[model samples]
Target: MHMGKSYQVSAKVDEGMLASALGSGDVGVLATPVMLSLMEQAACACVQDCLKEGETTVGAQIDLAHISAVPAGMEITATAEIIKIEGKKVLFKIFCEDREGIVGKGTHLRLIVNRDKFQQRAAAKVK
Candidate 1:
């Protein structure tokens, strides 16, 4: 099994967007900035899918740029590919596109962690 794999994620882009230069005021269909979230989630899933026996996955870092402002009600798709693997740590590259063109790109890192201990440590971080 390999950690650096690829996956396709479907998305809904917003429509009717406008730039700040236009004072009249029309805003693009605001979305939850799905690209970043999708990229991270895909990396996590890939790490989990490729984990060997007794291994678990956890997200470590994600560097992404949301380049395009998609209007409300449009559709988009983001693709993620794992680029490197170091033992329990995996690196991925993600790209996103909508009807207009490329919207975002970035690299992400995920680490295989002990499930029980990971959860405990995460819960403790919430001060």
Candidate 2:
């Protein structure tokens, strides 16, 4: 796969469910999943971008830093860029910016493999 490719992704949060006093939530913990979803999307898109050139590494892991908070109703966007390559493994630098500000930033690691087989192996590992 070719290097230096980038991908963009976005998501909006529902403010009503993010309030601290609401029966189901706490603000800090609530937005974490939103940031994670963006990261996952960005990482996946980056992998797809790489595949356009040729079959390349896929996401194996992610290291994320949630530095800012996003209230409900705000949208978050993530951009992932390929930074390095090691054989079948790829390294990406991910940044997430939202209506509030930079909500999260991270480094993601990916490795390539047959998709269907990967899922089967992953399921077996859980058991």
Candidate 3:
């Protein structure tokens, strides 16, 4: 993947994305896990066009801080920019924002893998 390239994904906060609905908290704001998923979705989009057939990236790690609460009906955008690439390990600077301002920021790491192989390995765990 090329360093500095970025991608964004946006979604409106809904009842299902709320902390109360997701069981992450008792409040009605956005859930941290959902925000992280958005970040990961943006990260995946960043390098999707560059991957070869059967190759895909998986989230390896994340360090995030949710600084603001976003209520349902608000739109939030998550951006992921490639900061570093070491072999198949890609590091991204991630951010989440609403119309008010930044709601979260962090770093995320993704590892490139063969999709079929990864799926097979995961399925084998149940056998």
- Candidate maximizing lDDT: 3
Model 2, poorest ten-residue lDDT window?
21-30
List candidate 3 segments past 4 Å from native.
none
All candidates: TM-score: 0.74, 0.75, 0.97
- For residues 1-127, could you state the per-residue lDDT of candidate 1 as single tens digits? 4544688777664342333223334454433345676666666665566666666876788787768776756777777787887777778888777888988888877788778887888799999
Q: Assess each prediction's global lDDT (C-alpha) against the native.
A: 0.68, 0.71, 0.97
| lDDT comparing candidate 1 with the true structure | 0.68
The global Cα lDDT (0 to 1) of model 2 is 0.71
TM-score of 3: 0.97
lDDT of 3 at 81: 99
Query: How many clashes in each candidate?
Result: 8, 4, 0
Give the per-residue lDDT of model 3 (tens digit) for 7-52: 9999999999999999999999999999999999999999999999
In what order do the candidates fall by TM-score, top score first? 3, 2, 1
Mind sharing the TM-score for model 2? Answer: 0.75
| Candidate 3 collision pairs | none
Q: Which tens-of-lDDT digit does each residue in 16-55 have in candidate 2?
A: 4353635444653335655666776777777774463334
Residue 6, model 3, lDDT: 99
